[model samples]
Target: MDEKVLLGHGSGGTMMRRIIDEVFFDAYGGEELAAGNDAADLPLPAEGERLAYSTDSFVVTPHFFPGGDIGHLAVCGTVNDVATSGAAPKYLSCGFILEEGFPMEDLKRICQSMADVAKEAGVRIVTGDTKVVNRGHGDGVYINTSGVGFIPAGRVLGGQYCKPGDKVLVSGTLGDHGITIMSCREELSFRADLKSDAAPLNHLIAEVLEAAPHTRCFRDPTRGGLASTLNELAEQSGVDMVVDEMNVPVKDAVRGACEMLGYDVFQVANEGKMVCVVPAEESELALEAMRANEYGTDAAIIGEVLPCPDDRSPRVSIRTGFGSMRILDMLVGEQLPRIC
Candidate 1:
């Protein structure tokens, strides 16, 4: 019960749970972080294989958006996470928190959207739960989705597997989701027609893995976007990385909006884009596989990993088109709230 809590330490034991209950619950009567799990395989009765599991909660302000809704996002987010571990997502459980007096028609629409996207992704919603909160208590609706998938035999992928000479590839243009959400908000309304890139990447990932069997890892840049994701990878692999600014695919509208609003495009959130790190030799194979997918037509190989001396700390830097380099640091604080 006397354990110290860090920023990213998920509560899986009594210590962090105690802290949440004591501090958070005492203040709000809710312990949100009492339990959580990362995207990793869970041990099961099966011997030669394992199942990858991941869970996510969606509370996007605008229940509906240009490209997707909360229900669609809930499924894609969790599915993508499980897939990053080289698993073929199969089943999902959805839980909905609906506000009293919420429109049944909208609820029905969101549910249908979930079904459509789920079917498209080749996954099933096996079970679900629903609860209604007081009229003013809940925001229209919130969804939590948990998924599991079976990892193929003899397949292992993770950031820790990255090494020098690995190539970095992005599924498509960045910041569309974050910027789209921003443009949709009524409070700070902006004129843009960007759509949320919230789509299941399981199939695309499957193809990439098939083509590039030696891939180091796959990461969907969500809340903290590509910069944070790459920083975490660099630290995990203990290697340096050099990303070319011009090589990264950021849509013109997104780039312009970020420039005008003073936001780092690299730090913008993405719901449907994935970051892939593979061996230099098979990088093209990975690129080809990604480009073949509908969601990854704009995929590009943006950078390469470099050796980091034992005495020097690993770093991620970006090479500008103007012949200069600057450190690409991880996002420090919340850039946008409830972005995913």
Candidate 2:
């Protein structure tokens, strides 16, 4: 109680139980969550509606940073993950791993942030778990979140839904989240301000679905940036992608950071944004829907799905601003490690 927590907290014994009961349970009070099970038995929604579920973990260093913190990141990450599946996010369960010596006030702040984000996203934090680790055994805090949502009937979205001539669109500027976290962790200074674009994107996805229900796929370019996400789409759909470098929106601050660090913005990570693939004919309509939303005011059409040049494997290609073309491969290993 004097210190934050020790390794015994994660031992799944008395210490862990105490942390869960005393801290987590006390913060998120409810009966559905009191069972303390790995998977919650959720009630079904009204007939004809389908359910969407998603899970994600956050390990961003410097738990507190510009634009957002681990609490917001954990909530939005899972909410967007479920939203990308073409669902209206409804509920979330959070798990926390705390390092010894961490401040209790910090833990309370993080929980409050989570609650605020959940309320804003129109979702609820139904249940959660907590554990602690030795001082040197863990970072300050790590959060894992899982979310559930309801998808309307007759609506289908998946990687396989992509086809030649589909359009690729991103909600707003790229690499903001990765660059912001990098600057804070490295203590880098710059003329222009940079902040993480961590946010809940369920609203944008929901709007796009309403305007154009035929979207092929929706994915947030996190961990592995835009290029990596396109690569995933190509591999999944067996179709190549042609992107225009000039069409992709990247903030000046982010570009500057990438240039100085020898990092590719397309290969960096993002938290609050999303990429949507829609049929070519409905691309304009989808753009309108996204642009109307605050999170996607700068939304742009960056590329199109096409028949792979190689008959065997699909890949992503970008027409550079210089008018040359280049293959956009997946980010090797970890592009920005420890970046949510």
Candidate 3:
């Protein structure tokens, strides 16, 4: 590891994992922290009660984008993390670090956006804190959100729970959020309409869980995108994954943007999408449930888990559009920075 942290350490790829394992985890190792799920599952004070808790910070540049803004990202990110554990997100705490002299009007708008999203997700922002940093010491605004949710009885989910015969599914198209941010950041113009796919997925997740109670795992392909996310799940579950390229949805506009920018759609961020692993028999039910939600209309079964090969090393392989297979590894470095 390097003596100083680099942006790659936060890229949610190999470097990030190394830092977590060698630095943070080394210093703060524990059963809860070591589990390495999107959120921490904790035993509640009341018997038979369990809670999922997670925290996330947003530093997206521009703050405002096509379909959503930083405030929306902050609320949805934390809410999705808690909900990924099969919990119903209930409450959130927000903390803001504002640059001195920042415009008050923009701040108000951001807060209202957060309020609206929280209400939509059926979660409440019950607590928060505010801090002002020197004019040059901070971005326009940065938001940190911590959320807690109640887990249903006898419901268990995590990457490690995935089995060889489980099916893999994604809620909708990949890379919309990442490409939208890139185009906005670089001020690129395109004939095709481009927008961020940023939305809260708690409601959609609830529906899927209701229909596919045997869901083995749930993950939001955010920072490092679907490739890193699926790789993590495969390694954790000690299984292999074979994904079909044609089945992984990608909008024409997003594909065009990626081609123009040399971005790999599989490795781009998506704020409003999720990957669900469930028993093969229940895949149809899961897909049907997801499609019933607005956020998951393009839902599809993209892949299937396979037993590890002779070497017993977990791996992810994608069948390319050209009908060739290739291993998908984590991104070597950050492709787009300051992207939520």
Model 2 C-alpha lDDT per residue in residues 108-227, reported as the tens digit of each score: 778778877888899878877777777887788999999999988877888777899899999999999999888888899862398889999998898998898788889999988998
In model 1, residue pairs whose N, Cα or C atoms come closer than 3 Å (at least 3 residues apart or on different chains), thus clashing, are none
Q: How accurate is candidate 1 locally (lDDT)?
A: 0.83
TM for every model, in the order presented, reads 0.85, 0.92, 0.86
Ranking of predictions according to lDDT: 2, 3, 1
User: Highest lDDT: which candidate?
Assistant: 2
RMSD of 3: 10.9
RMSD of each: 10.2, 2.3, 10.9
lDDT of 3 at 289: 99
**Among all candidates shown, the one with the greatest TM-score:** 2
Candidate 3 least-lDDT 10 residues: 23-32
Better of 2 and 3 by TM-score: 2
- Candidate 1 residue lDDT tens string, 183-251: 788434354557889999999999999899999999999998999999999999999999999999998
Global lDDT of each candidate: 0.83, 0.87, 0.86
Worst 10 residues of 2 by lDDT: 1-10
Tell me the TM-score of model 2.
Answer: 0.92
**Which candidate, 1 or 3, would have the higher lDDT against the true structure?**
3
